[model samples]
Target: MPGYKNPDLEYLDQQGNVVGYGEVKTVGDADQSAFNKQLAKAVKQLRVREDVEGKMDVNEIFIQVPDLVDAREVRGWFRSYQKGRLHHGSDLEKISGYHVRVYTGSGSKLADVDLGVDADGGHYDESTHTYYSSNGYSY
Candidate 1:
């Protein structure tokens, strides 16, 4: 919204008289680029939160360190992806904690699952093999 100002603050000349006419400008290329960058960052953060939350919602399943891989690492180096749709930060700034449960396989237990990473950039627990809850809030 455009702000309301005293008439003097608007079109006043050196003599404090209205010029009667002036130009109203639109956002320029630079402004658009800045907006885009900020938008991307926001999206990245949202995606990161969703991804972390999804994994944490999985039932309790404890696996060894050698079992699964960090999906983020496999994906790419993202300070935040797609502008911030996914924030690949040290901290998982989305989920509170995890609800883990194990499901046994018939013969082979493939360790190609999600290993939740906390905001501090640490694995939840190597032995428990479950995603950890945040400190009551996402950072």
Candidate 2:
């Protein structure tokens, strides 16, 4: 018609080919509730597929720890002197014993030593010098 002032909706196929007639887009007589319900269902399905079951766990992930380390030891013999340079034992044995290394912020490295949690579990260095012990830790 000659005095048409409305836009048309051009339908396209899967291959982007125009195959059908055009229809005008309007808010007239639209089932908005049904459209919203379908949209919510699609979103729910996508969320379910990307759930925690589809994600990898910590045990399934792989990480590498260097056996031979060259960092500054904060406890035993080697200690840190400079700022931003802090290190503890790389080997499991050094941190296994009762006498563990402690760093004091009073300009003293290995200024204090504390006992571990028995012969099995170990002590935890809460702060630089503050130490706590636990016997339930695996390593």
Identify the candidate with maximal lDDT: 1
Q: State the C-alpha lDDT per candidate.
A: 0.29, 0.26
Residue range 41-139, candidate 2, lDDT tens digits: 332332233242342111110111122211122222211211111232233232222122222223233322222223222453544442222443211
- Scored by lDDT, model 1 comes in at 0.29
Tens digits of per-residue lDDT for model 1 on 1-139?
1222221112346787543221111112223343334333333343344344333222222222122334232122122322243444534333223221111222223222222333333344556444333422211
- RMSD for all candidates, in order, please: 21.3, 27.7
> Which window of ten consecutive residues has the lowest lDDT sum in model 2?
56-65
Best by TM-score: 1
> Alpha carbon lDDT of residue 105, candidate 1?
26
Q: How many steric clashes does model 2 contain? A: 0
